[model samples]
Target chain A: MLLRLSWLLALLLAALPARGAELRLLPPGLAYCDELAARFSRLPGARQDAARGLAAEGGRLCEAGHARAGVARLRRALRAAQGAPRLARSAHP
Target chain B: MPHTRRRQQHPGPLWRLLSSAGFRFALLFAVVFLAAGLAFAGVLWWGTAGTLERQTDSAIRADAMALAERGRDSGLAVLAEAVEERLALDAEGLSIYLLLDPSGRRLAGNLAALPPPRSGDSSWYRLNVEHEDTGPGEARLLVLDLPDGSKLAVGREVSEKGRLRALLTEGLAWAAGAALFFALLGAWLMRRALERRLTPAATTAALIAGGDLSQRVPLSLHDDEFDRLGASMNAMLDRIAHLMDGVRGVSDAIAHDLRTPIARARNGLEEALLSEADDPATLRGAIERGIADLDNVTRVFQAVLRIAEVEAGARRAAFAPLDLSLLLADAAELYGASAEARGQTLNTLWPESLPLVGDRDLLLQVVANLLDNAVKFTAPHGTIVLSAWREADWVVVRVADEGPGLSAQDRTRVGERFFRADSARTTPGSGLGLSLVRAVVQLHGGALWFEDAGGPPGQPGLAVLFRLPVAA
Candidate 1:
């Protein structure tokens, strides 16, 4: 009886659409966020703590299925990274 | 050795077209039009694209100024909030903004990074932005340092504007290509038109060169430029043919007239040489007759040369203003004795002064020849009249004699070299007298003709009249 109930539950779970499959329909802002994040990562600077924090938050949001909010934050992080000097510099100098 | 004939090489159609005046004119016209088109395109590009760029720059400048004022008044926090709000409102995602703290930390906006600093913080910069949806784009940016040790960047993506400019440039290129095509077509058509108009003249000329003197350029009733040109060419051909006929007639007459005298002289001399008896009187008589015949040939040659000289305008340099009346009186006085000796009454009527410009010797010779003909042709006791008068712009002279007038056919042939009326064939004079008179009168810009002198029935005398321009 227990084995039959377990098989029935497994079949029900298989019949429902998967979350990963649903997430495959990419949001409009996801590509933009990825572009901004990639650009920020390539920037050469020392004092990028604020940008790093924002980028981390944006990545968590995107992974949590909040793509629009993630893109907004990633854009702000990119703007912050732009303020950094081209050469490395001390954060509190 | 057999001679090999070389074939003539004619230019090809392309070569002819390239060398034609019509094609050159068309090319020049096309070049001028292209230059004008280029100038017009340049102006259009400057007016449209340039104005759009200027407006974009102005908008960027004004936006940066407004943002700077806001940042100054409301502090960094408010400025950052305003930038975020503005970016959220930009549905096209063309707006670009960046704010930086003193420590180079991201505060707000959409730019991936600050562009490398140029000369100063206040200066404008052009940046390439990588947009996810639209590929790479150009942005006009103004980066400014706030009073609180922060920086702000304000810009707008201008990819659409760049695309528009590219489209305009492409259109201009296409327009230029089309213009070139039409210009070449026009040149080809113009060349063909010119060739069509000129072909008749060229063919006629070729036929004439091949010895067909009767060939003439065909004409159209349109009377356009080409028709006028054909008419002129035809007129020229007619004149050439007429002159050629005259030359042929002169050659035939010379042969006929010269052969008789020469044959006569030769026969007389040969007879004298062959005589067995040594008769001095007969030999002397033959020699004298031969000398007279030779002298007659010499006179004919001299007369021919004089006519040619007059026709060539060689004696025009000797022309002078003089009283034609006096010249006529002189001629009458000189010929009067000959006329009287011939048993013909000589009479003169003249104006005291008939002004004219002419070569004096030629005019005197003309008068003398006319009087000589009159005196020779008039019957015994007949009347000969010499008269001169000024009429209108002309000085008129007439020599009338009581002799049989010329037939209409003879009148037309009178001035031709070696031509003579059948009635005057027995008269003692070369037929060249009237020819010389005609040449002299023509050279002096005068007209000469003949008419009946109005005598009793069966005595209709001849009147030879000439008129010279008073100024000539």
Candidate 2:
């Protein structure tokens, strides 16, 4: 029965829909960027520079008018920051 | 919740649209291609409108700043002429603009007047600016009092936003078309996949309906859901074939097995009927003969039922490991004595410790049946040999006799229930021996076959082979 269930899961996976690969980063403004960064304070402090680099990349992308790439990169940066130690300090503050 | 339930009861339009093959294929094709087209239109609109708006806003601001740097009255005159040129009534097309003072008077612009702001109006509005000269509606750009006190307005004959919106609407219509196209393509693929699956099923059903009981549906790669369906149908047909053959053969078997003793009983009864004295010994003989015939009939029915039960495999629970060598020895010894009395020599070759998994009674019966068949088939002065040994995975037993070997065609039908070889039609035994042998062998998950036991066929006979699985 467990084997049967696995087979069914495989078939279900085969039937899944394809989706566009896209990302959205620091909206059009700095305020939007800061608000998003605060939300993404989960990244480790050690990784914060990496996150910043990614955001810079996203900014570069947005400048190039590739908003999808920009958003994706920014989202990745925010996700990385979600684990930041500084977020714990600010949670109560 | 009720609405949800109702919705479930009544499938959505999208599902209905998806369910139809034509619609689904068209939809899939349309989704891919039309999405491409729609995405193209959207990007076109965004790029054109955004660039135009940015340029216009910058141009207007620069013009206003330049004018405000001059004296206010002179600037107003210059602005009027500039505004007139910049905001010339959009080719008499309503793509126009207006600059209004804080009091709602047009400071210097081509627009006739400013309509009161719609309720809860925001920073900017894309309004359908109308015109008496042009047709129904025209789009306009309106700017209010500037911080510098020089109201600025500039318009272009090209209505980018309006055109973009029109383009988007067109794109959506195109998207819907693309959706239909994609749906059709998907449905065509689905049908082929369905056909690949459905074809074997339809063929199998046709095969069955056409009376080919032995025919089977071939399994495909993956053994998918369709294969499951095929397997299920195959099982059903298997049962049907068994029953149809079983009923005809069973009835015939009952008759053949019963008739020998029945004829004996009739002969005895007729003698008693014709006798002058109703003698006690004569009556006893008649009654005994009748009883014997009835008993034989009962035995035949019991054998049939036992074979049926074994084939059903439900009695595998009663299965146990048994000594196969001992069973063969016993059959050979018993038959050895019987054959000796019948003027035939019995030979034996029993090996040690053939650890086999089988029902003791069934294994014993299999050995007994083989020995009995060899003894019955061979003539007087013939030698019957019974032997056993382990080979590969099976404990095989052989019972060969000095008798006439069955032809190839006859050998094939040897295990069929109630099938007696034409030469054996005059034999006094029921044809159920080898049939029962087959049933027992199958119950043990083994096989029975014939082999040329490499002896003189005249006095040392046809060989019968039985193989059973040896316990690991």
Candidate 3:
């Protein structure tokens, strides 16, 4: 019986993905995060840390299997990445 | 020619572009296009941004309701757990949540603190929550007062909407710039093409204005406006040249005709002064001859002025309807005695009452001139026929003379002022007789032409034919 229960558990685990093991199984949250990180890299060094932090959080949510929430987080990360350079330029100037 | 030479030193391309009409038109188009583009962009921004904002606000409200229901179903402990789960689920950090205790301490969610609650039932805030992580951004917050006096808040990031608006604005600006560049280029090309077509006419006009009367506008096979203008200008130039030649001829004839008479009078006076018989009859005879010579010169001048007045068209006011057949018969009758003395037979053909509108004196002079020329040029015993008849809308008059007819070349030039036929140069009288006749015919809106009156094969004499319009 214990062995049958362990097999059932294995089937359930297969049905519900553990996390970012299969990226295609999730939403486009991680892909969006990567795109935003690439854009932020072009900004000046003074504001790079804040942009990286936002992207890292978005990637974490995507890895944790919260796809819908992950997409929203990634969108926020992109906005932050886009806005950082302008804010840095203004603050420094 | 001098003007054309000056025009060849044209200004450079840049100067032409700045001064060209096409450039100004293109600039006007650019300004209008920019204004229209801005208006379109504004409408696009309003539509897209407004939709995005409304959607974002609704999502925020839904999130707030979900959390409030979660708290109502269980307690603050369960609500706080749900907030933690949501924060973990949201990898993008776009969702916001906060659970506050009765003393207002933030218990859960991504935000650092519970923002101060508002007085109204619902309100939106532009305040920044994750300032250290994502810089400043727009957020719509909804704070709900829990049954236990604690607070729950939810928000969604709205900075992406702003980014979209920025991208659209930048795109519109770039498009407007590209449109202006292309418009200016097209305008310059158009101006160049127009200038190429117009340059020839402008050059010809400049040359003509610079005292080159012989210059004429060039023509093309294409019957366009420019070609028509060239033809009209060429015709006008030809007329001016013809009139100039006429003036030159009249001046030469005046000098030649006056010199002989003046010289004869001077010689007679000198001879009388040198004579030893100082009698009054000899002096009176010399003075009388001089007076006659002066009178002849005076008559020539008077005839020239009369012809000029008729050609000026000022005698049209004196015109009235008169019977042309009667007028022809009267002229033939008046000259019949002279014709008989010269042993010439005068015949008349009349269509009873041929009517015309003209100056009576001028018409009489036309017939009289033709008759006088016939008498002067014809041999004795020649036949003269005077005829008047109506043909279509005109009254045709003919005074056919059996005289030595003129050549075709002489007939063409006979109506020019002071133009005398080569065969008749030795005859007495000024060469203005036929010219005055032509001027009178034209003033009456008629035509005067010469034809060979049919007679024997080799003796076809001149026919002076005139046609005048019958008045309504």
Quick one: best TM-score, which candidate? Answer: 1
> How well does each candidate superpose onto the true structure, as a TM-score?
0.73, 0.57, 0.62
Name the fnat for model 3. Answer: 0.05
Better of 1 and 2 by TM-score: 1
lDDT of 2 at B317: 80
Candidate 3 - CAPRI tier?
Answer: incorrect
List the candidates ranked by TM-score, beginning with the highest: 1, 3, 2
lDDT by residue (B256-341, candidate 1, tens digit) is 89898999999999999998869899899999999999999999999999999999999999999988878888888899989888
Model 2 chain B: which ten-residue window has the lowest total lDDT?
A: B86-95
Chain A vs. true chain A, TM-score per model, equals 0.53, 0.43, 0.40
Against the native complex, each candidate's DockQ, computed on alpha carbons, is 0.02, 0.01, 0.03
List where candidate 3 sits over 4 angstroms from the true fold: A1-93, B1-168, B205-212, B219-224
**lDDT value for candidate 3?**
0.73
Error of 1 at B6 (Å): 16
Tell me what fraction of the real C-alpha contacts between chains A and B each candidate also makes: 0.00, 0.00, 0.05
- Model 1 shows how many backbone clashes? 4
